[model samples]
Target chain A: MATAALTLYELAAADAALRFSPHCWKTRMALAHKGLEAERVPWRFTEKAAIAFSGQGMVPVLVHDGETVTDSWAIALHLEQRFPDRPSLFGGNGAMPLARFVNGWADTVLSPAIARIIVADVHGRVHAADRDYFRTSREQRFGQALEDVVADRPANLAAFRRALQPLRRALAGDAFIAGPAPAYADYCVFGMLMWARCISDVELLEPDDPVSAWRDRLLDAFGGLARSAPTARG
Target chain B: MATAALTLYELAAADAALRFSPHCWKTRMALAHKGLEAERVPWRFTEKAAIAFSGQGMVPVLVHDGETVTDSWAIALHLEQRFPDRPSLFGGNGAMPLARFVNGWADTVLSPAIARIIVADVHGRVHAADRDYFRTSREQRFGQALEDVVADRPANLAAFRRALQPLRRALAGDAFIAGPAPAYADYCVFGMLMWARCISDVELLEPDDPVSAWRDRLLDAFGGLARSAPTARG
Candidate 1:
């Protein structure tokens, strides 16, 4: 029995050192949780050609054992099955659906809310070649200039914080969202916060918020994997 | 060993047969999932004295033997810990926190959105002795009449449906939110729907929506426990 090489194409900022796509971060954390290290190939938004082999324009594309898996959620599921002897990504199969719900919440609600507050900052930090593409697509989707979308950031920040009440309440009596230890559910949310921290200056959460505390724990997990990641936030 | 006798005080409408409180419904579904039956006692909002022994004014108070439990979340936890051999409500201890997050989301996000759409209907259905108390307390909280709060129901309904994107996305790949089988997580969302159905004529979900399908399955679960329950929705 032989193990195959693993590689992950992750979204990167202008510096290339700044790898910060929320979806990609989820895959990164899941890999670390399984005690596996993959070569992270830095990818820019305009560099769709690099990931074409995966048949998708988006990344967090994982090439494992010469097999291609796209989408962060699918990659996470793949890792769990491939490394059953390692720490379980979902605690057990029964928890998978619940974790999926949390994954959906992060994708549909959490990340979208955070993106509105940091879209301008994200545009500013992208590679020069990707700036126009980023702005045009995002601006059209939002139906406004990125600058205008983020102009009322103070209000956006409040709304974002208010949206976090459920997470805060859940963490009040537990150490992590999945219970005693961090799991895929924690990764789903930390990935979003890491994305915000890596490419934006806006502090989406207050220092005292329980969610902020939970984020701190995740940052310190896996030998400070997320804490050591490149950041644009001061 | 003798098992403790269990009795649940559930919220009821003027008819006493129409039990509709979302929190109470959570407990009901949980008990049924565990295959445990408890005597259901009808309680009205103004009848706080009936539950005074629990040191709380809320319904869904569980009295087992000489022990008393208040709050739906607490009672669910108690039942799981006390009846370990019965069907697990959260799958396992590891899934508890994730279920708690779902519980919190149902309480803070789902129920509040539904409330704004059906509050006036709720006020109209409570026991006559409780109408003034329900209307006054809720009106004061909203800073407007209940009718005014729900007057623009078309807009409120749209917002409520939009808020369900995550739930809908989660159900796309699985039959239940907790995955292949129903669990506490399913109960959390179903309870809110039960509240709307029991007290309001308004349709909170489109008939073709996946969420509605999931709700229908829950209604038919546990030998039609929820299905047999009274509903005001035609």
Candidate 2:
């Protein structure tokens, strides 16, 4: 007589005016694609103490209602269960397996390398315009040699291409990483570098690459919305 | 009254193996704790390529009946759903949230830094003795000046320590990262650095840290069970 009894709770939403982060952006982008909206809570860099309240130690945490959802993958799982009708962000049949693989690749392979590449580029050549952000936050982490990270960009970016080679191979024929449409894996990978692509000259991906092109398709789907989403927050 | 032809597949066993990874050890540890039996398949260096057949990029994957489950986190999820009677590897009412958070942190925060320190140390000082195992795998990706990576180390390791500062606060009085018993997060973090500790002459985790003590407790619970298991044919 009883089903799973899974009453869905909306996680941090876009309306909260939260500072966009790579981790959060991926999930948000997924929500955008899936047409599922949740309440947003802006996470500030200075609010380290507040953020750590979950004890999971980061943002993009989907607190389905009051109980916090940890890990982007788990959040993805939660999203699918909550919104089964719109579309399976993961494909239907064989695509689920493919999605599983690509998702893992995103989390394990592309995510970490892209993170390093993003930071170096963002805090380096791009952030020169707004030097204080880097000087304060990155300085605390990497100290003074932020210059070296920038200096070796030609080489480091080469490594980025190398790291991305696997994704390139995986997404060669498909419109998306898992299948014909963008799934959770697509958003997860795209989420990390979007901010860098947004604020800086660093083009980690290209419109030519199928993966990049697919991302453009998503942008066309969302950018009109991210742009038109009552920017004045009425 | 007829069911929807549900084939009640009574708990089938699966086989999962790692390619000389101590991180893989955690999966084995769980299998042992649950007393779940699986076939063993040991792999070599780039020998992990076969894991792709499982529709995943890397090990340690669990193949149950016909379904191939990849991603260690996903495997744990599958195991919990398929086998719910085991002593919960994810502890407490908050176990799921804790598992997701800690598991994510283990991969993101701890593994990257630990991997850097381990690779630099292993390839720099101990390359000769370890030469037999890793003939093809180079110390650095694309030969990107290990010196730059190496040069980045002192700073990187310091930042690594800073990341750990959050954990120190998390584990001040708690027996585990989330509770008294070790959970998926503990194993996840432990798995990433297992080989680093086993192979490295110097201590990887700070000797005085509560995490070190916590890790030791986990080690005792594991009791070297992860490294060796009885194979189907053995």
Candidate 3:
């Protein structure tokens, strides 16, 4: 697969280089897993027209040789099928579906929990053109103002940490969710943490948490791909 | 390979035929998945001495040709390794660790949620000798009387159902948690529901829930092994 023709539209902050969407991070890790490279174009929340060709108002849109694929899960599948010779993303067997469960858990449970704690921080970092769009849509979804959603962040943070028990227990027995090697399953949950890491200064995991250890491993994976990214705290 | 020498100690109710421990059910499904049969020995909570030979007090102790294996996860691993030619519990690849995550979720999240609603029922159904032991241990764990924990059962039931979003979302895209076919991962979560099914009359799932559909499929798996069991409702 030629890297020159692959282009990915990633969600970017006002600074552009601080890409932080959890869904997009899943795709980024997957691309790195497959040893594939793409020219990443910074996209903002209000810039729906930029990704209109994909027929969806979402970033992490992968355009490969003129074929557009949207949704992080679909893009992962696309890359896996189109580049089978690269390292297997799901590690073959029946892991793909299990990875899908991890993906679903991350979306329905992990990301939502993290969002409650960092949604306000997210609003502050989006491109200025996207701020109102981000706040209105998120406020409607959350049924409150962004600041109010994070008002009880101490409690919300505790709940978010409690919600990670399954992931913590899973990591206690293995290096990654997918086993010894960090695969798509690891990327799925890691993407959620990366979202928090990039946009918020609030500590989501304890310094000694197994999840923190697992996240550290993934942050250092693929030549420190996630670790080297700029954070709001810095 | 020899089914005759395999004996499994499963948690039994007042009536020995009504076996309902969730962890034990995970092992039972794994056994059936491998086409291996074991002599089901009825065990009760108070009968720690019975399983003491395994150096632990838990049921789901598989004594295979005098080699004792304790814990459901270890037993599943034992079955997969010992009976590799029959069928796989995990569908090979890297699914074992992912299944471990599912197992952790079931134990830490799903079972505890279901237990709050069914502990009183479980207390009522245990063998007469085990009732006091069950009540004392559970009440301490819950920090209340068995009846108190389930007093607001209607609310508890709703929370239990809500906690199943990850499983529900996973099943929406596929027939089972492990994809098209039921595997150990499905059994891990299904075991928790079976615990509720056997010992409680409360409808933990709505009839239209995808989780209900998945449960029905597993209930009918292995020649109606689970469906044939007597429930407290009956």
Candidate 4:
């Protein structure tokens, strides 16, 4: 177990790997938003042995200072806590509840909808035979089904759009998911959907909607985090 | 949208709730450990609402002060950062990595293992009807899984037990999941297993093992929380 060479607690701050994940992209953006420098390690999905030792087996794992953060949600929470100064990823004032509500709404509603498209599309497109592998793994890991997991993809996507319409209206052409300042939640959802776009199509991102403009705005807030990398000290 | 009565900014402290999760008990316990206070809202299973609003869906969802945090991993990260003055749930010195390693092990290996049995048990025994509700709701909401959507109970239970064996062994003689002082990961995993126990059989606890005793310590630590609500003031 070549575990996290440096645990999150070991480092003075987070020194993490972006891990080439869209989810990791969110954490990196949050870190950048907070102006914290982190180490970036690129990991492959096929190599289970790479992240085998860590508790959570997903991407975008952040090792703050030295503590390893496995999931993107966990990484952002860690960053927010580690760095409370500068720009806050969580919205301010009334936006907090908006942020919280949006946060939960996305977790329970949007992501799963997107995940169905993500896993099935990505797996079907990329690893056809490995679909069984993916299915079996998820079943063992989450006890969820891969095949027929969703009763209807179209309905799922439509409902997903409905659930997100509130946020889109909330965005109402605003630059972020919650408000003027992008909260951490924005980055997380952005990363996940971005992955969908990467594997599937940009149409999933919704053309001409407030979300599109909002995505552009967030990119502007972080100075195109998707395109930038850390300085040497990072 | 009653929303948060307090402007998100006005909401001092926060609440961390696991996603419809019985597993995030440890996060609540850690809040108790740090003497930090936050609101408590149980999480929802559907990912859309959680994600659209929060960013991610999985729990323990933590609203620090009022910032929306998703995933148990994130909650722990937030806790340590928000309450830096307190002793870390990970541990003091070199033990941080060991604690983290174990925590990850639990999440990746132990959690899923425990989840197989837990979800199957919960879906079948306690939530037979409710389980159908969730599946049906998913179908209605996302148009996914109209076909019974029954989890492979026997296979899952066997897999769950297989996953639990190693963890059960680790806890067989230990005082806690980690040591005398439980860490954040312990709470994450503990919350999961305990939640399973809450709705399922006590036999799942394995009294001879350390988790049985460790649970007591967590209960004690968690028994008293820095409730944002106070009965009286001078």
Highest TM-score against the true fold, candidate = 3
In model 4, which regions exceed 4 Å deviation?
A1-22, A91-100, A124-132, A138-156, A227-234, B1-234
DockQ of 1: 0.79
Which of 1 and 2 is the better model by DockQ? Answer: 1
Give the better candidate number (2 or 3) by TM-score. Answer: 3
Q: Which ten-residue region of model 2 chain B has the weakest summed lDDT?
A: B4-13
| Better TM-score candidate (1, 3) | 3
lDDT of 4 by residue, B1-234 (tens): 122221111101112221224335566566666766555553334434634566644555566545776665556666677667776766532333233333444555555555544443444432222456555554564343433222554665555554454344445434555444556646656665555545444244546644556565665565533122221110
Error of 2 at A171 (Å): 8.3
Worst 10 residues of 1 chain A by lDDT: A1-10
TM-score of the B chain in each candidate versus the native B chain: 0.97, 0.71, 0.97, 0.63
Compute the lDDT of residue A3 as modeled in candidate 3.
56
The regions of model 3 sitting more than 4 angstroms off are A1-4, B1-4
- DockQ of predicted model 3: 0.82
| lDDT score for candidate 1 against the true structure | 0.90
Estimate candidate 4's RMSD in Å. 15.6
**Model 2 per-residue lDDT tens digits across residues A109-223:** 5554554555654443332333465456675665545565456666766766665654554455356554455566567667655545543456676557665766676666655
Give the alpha carbon lDDT tens digit for every residue of B15-112 in model 3: 99899999889999998998888999999888889889999888899999989999999999998888889778888858888989888988888988
Output the chain A TM-score of model 4.
0.69
